[model samples]
Target: MIESWVINDDSPVPVSSAGVVEALRSRIDSGQLETWLTSSSGRLLAFVTNAERAMVVLLEGEGGPGEHAVDPGAAGSSDGFVLSNGQGDEYPDEDTVPIREAFRLVEHIVGTGSWPADARWVVDR
Candidate 1:
């Protein structure tokens, strides 16, 4: 099954990619976030919403991370439609990379500080 964490976090941290991931993990570990989406076997998406901004982050069963912005209210419908499309969006674009590759980069960044500063800003996963 695919597990997803969704939370509303607006902490003031350095504006960096690592900061983002840290925030996510912190929220999850603090029990301030809950699983907003769940599945047995497919793409998992989590929608994080706050008063000023919202984000939809997705992790494929065998892929890495892809995130995009979403309307606070449309997250549910958007995730539903994506899942209904057979594990991929019917209308994919060039802004995102494959999940495995992204995850590999994330791992390297965490271990050696080789940041994947170029990971695409995905519109859909």
Candidate 2:
């Protein structure tokens, strides 16, 4: 199980189901744009957003492949969506989901320490 989560590289806090959900909600509601959840086991879930669209990336271990939740039917003419931090990072529009979905994904990973099988994922090679 996940022992704790760090928000935006801040000091770590004990992980609780409600805490995780509230953190995500507060981030979105406040338009923080960039927040990261790091598990005690070294797993990292990076959340970046443009307010309406968000990306949740799951990294399993040190140098392990990263998996991203994707919206299978989302189509766009542009190359990808940009999620700006210091230097901007881009993810395919299809790889971005609604903020609510991001909340669900983060909650599942934090609560169970595993990915939810219901969503489509693109794994890094």
Candidate number of the best TM-score: 2
The best candidate by lDDT is 2
- Candidate 2: stretches off by over 4 Å: 1-3, 77-84, 88-90
Candidate 1 global CA lDDT score: 0.36
Where does candidate 2 have its weakest 10-residue lDDT segment? 77-86
Q: In candidate 1, how many Å is residue 47 off?
A: 1.2
**For residue 50, what is the lDDT in candidate 1?**
25
| Collision pairs in model 2 | none
Global lDDT of each model? 0.36, 0.72
Backbone clashes in each candidate structure, one number apiece?
1, 0
Clashing pairs in 1: 64-99
Candidate 1 is scored at a TM of: 0.26
lDDT per residue, candidate 2, 1-125, as tens digits? 33666674555556576677787667667756677777787888888776666788888765788988888988862222334344555566787887778878888887787678897778977
The predictions' CA RMSDs to the true structure, in order, are 15.1, 2.8
TM-score of each: 0.26, 0.79
